[model samples]
Structures are given as C-alpha cells and as structure tokens.
Target: MDRKKIVEIISNHYSPLTPECKLDLITNSKLLVLQKGTVLVRGGQFSDKTFFIVNGCARAYYLKDGKDISDWFAFENEFISSINSFFLNIPSPHFIELIEDSVLLEISRGNIEILSNTYHDFERLSKVVAIKTMLKQQERITSMQFHSAEEKYKNLLSIHPDINQRIPLTHIASYINITLETLSRIRKRLTRI
Candidate 1:
C-alpha cells in the first residue's frame, strides 16, 4: 500500500492528520501482508503493536476452559490491538489473529506516544479511536446482557450484514454468547421470515 492511502485511511477512520503528522505516521508505521490464521499477539504476551486493517479481517479472542470465545473484530478500515497490553504495558489476556489474508498498517506504542505528544491532530485521532473502540465494547456487553438470541443475531447482522460471509459462524456465535445450534436456528428462522 502507498503512503497516501495509509494517510487517507487514518484520516477517515479517526480524525484528519496534519501534513507533518501524516509524514510521521507514514515513516513510523510498517505495512504488513499477513495470511489467514496469523496470530499477531498471543495470550500472555506483551504486545505494543496496533494494526489498522487496510484489507481483510482480524479478531481478538480468548481461550477459556478449552473453548475459544471472540471478544472483538476489526475489518477493513478498522483497528485492532491487544488493548490491555498496549495501554497498561501488561501481558495480553486475549489473542489477536488474522481471519483472512490481510494488508495492515502496524504502528508501535512508542511511535503512537511520540506522534500523540508532538501533534495535536494525532492526539485527537488517538482519543477518537479509543472512544470508538470502547463504545463498541459497551454495545457488545449490552447486547449480550439484554438481547435474546434472535435479537442479538439480528443486531449483529444490522451492524455487519456481510459478517456471515466474512467470518466463521462459530466465532460469531461465541462473540454473541450463543451456541452454534442456536445461531443456526436463528439464521434459519430469520431467513424464513
């Protein structure tokens, strides 16, 4: 991917960058092309790298009691990181994995700090992105707490209509706290309706 495209994606996702901020990001961020099933950050690893998906998808998930449960997903134009590890300088509790062959822009925590400290625009961009990620987590929690299986499935579909095509159903079921059978039934019922 070219520098201009990366800058455009950053501006579109967060806030517009200054000319200098754009240059700094272009210089600091690394372009990555990774295949499906690449684990960028594993559970218990300290990871300071954050990724912006230029193309394809990734998910942050945890392995609990031998079951894999997804917590978050990022697709084209979205960002994904081991948030706790990235911010708290601790080991990540979840794994970040690419779901498809992906093109990404990776930036280190040190670069983010430098850019945020030096550029007002970068700071604003970071704040905006963090707030957005937090709100998405909140929405997921609310949906899991109050929505019925069918309602949860519908709500997810509303946010990501093509998610079924892009992501595995098992991961989607886990993310919404449903069993695979329940998700299948819901999908069938909705299709008939």
Candidate 2:
C-alpha cells in the first residue's frame, strides 16, 4: 500500500493534513490488507488500535443472549475503533470485525495522542472526526428510541445508501433493532409501493 496515497485518502475524507503532519502520521501507522471475518477487537479485550478503512467495511457488534447485535458500521474512509477501550483504557464491550476483505490503515492511540499534541492540524482533524462520530451515535440513539422499524431502516438507508448491497440482512436488522423477518417484510412492502 502506498503511504502517500493512504494519507491522500484520509485528507480527502477528513480535514487536510499539513505536509509535516501527514508525514508523521504515515510514519506512525501501518497499511494492512485483512481478509473477511477478521476480528480486530473482541469483547473484554483491551483495544488500542483504530483502523481507517481504505477499502471495504467493518462493524462493531455485541453478543447478547447468544445473538449478535451490530451497533455500528464503518466503510471506506471511515474510522472504526472500540471507543470505550481506545479512549478510557477499559476492556471493549463489543467486537470489531471486518465484513469484507479490506485494506486498512492502522494507528495506535498512543501515536494518535503524540501526533495530536505535536501537530495542530492533526489535533483539528481528530476533533472533526470525533464530533462526526459523536453526532452519528446521537442520531442512532434517537432513531432507536423513537423511530418505528420501517423508519429506522429508512434512516439507516439514507445514511448508507448501498448498505443493502454490502451488508447482510441479519446484521442490518440487528443494527436497526428489528428482526430479520420484519426487515424482509419491510423491504418487500417498500418495493411494492
């Protein structure tokens, strides 16, 4: 993987990085190509690494009563990390798994902290990303709290337009807090309209 290309992609998705900041980030991170079903972080594990998806997608999910419930998804140019573990130094409550074979840029929290302190551009970029993540989480919480099943599905679709093509129905159902059967019925009903 080309480090410069990776940095360019990151800059395009988030804030533009100063040349020095970009160079330091390139030096501190790693480019990886991982296969599908790879588990980056597991429940109860300490997760210090955050991955920027260069290609493909991933999800953060929890196992509840032996069922997998997806809480978040990240695709190309997006970042995925066990937020609690990464920020609070606590064990992760969910698993982060790749949904497809993926190319990723991996960065450690320690390096992120160092870079953020050393570079104003990196600090600003970090703030922008964090705010975006926080807002997305807030939106999801509001949707889950108030939206009907169909509304939730539509909202998710609006955010990730190609989600149905890329993600499994079961995972989508779990993310939307609906059963697979109900999601299928909703899809069918929507198609008929």
Give all candidate RMSDs, comma-separated.
0.8, 0.9
* lDDT for residue 22 in candidate 2, whole number 0-100: 94
Cα distance off (Å), candidate 1, residue 187: 0.7
Whole-model lDDT for model 2 versus the true structure?
A: 0.94
Q: Number of backbone collisions per candidate, in order?
A: 0, 0
38-150: candidate 2 lDDT, tens digit per residue = 99999999999999999999999999999999999999889999999999999999999999999999999999999999999899999998988999899999999999999
Candidate 2 residue 164 Cα shift, in angstroms, is: 1.2
Highest lDDT, which number? 2
- Candidate 1: lDDT over CA atoms? 0.93
Q: What TM-scores do the predictions have?
A: 0.98, 0.97
Cα lDDT, all candidates: 0.93, 0.94
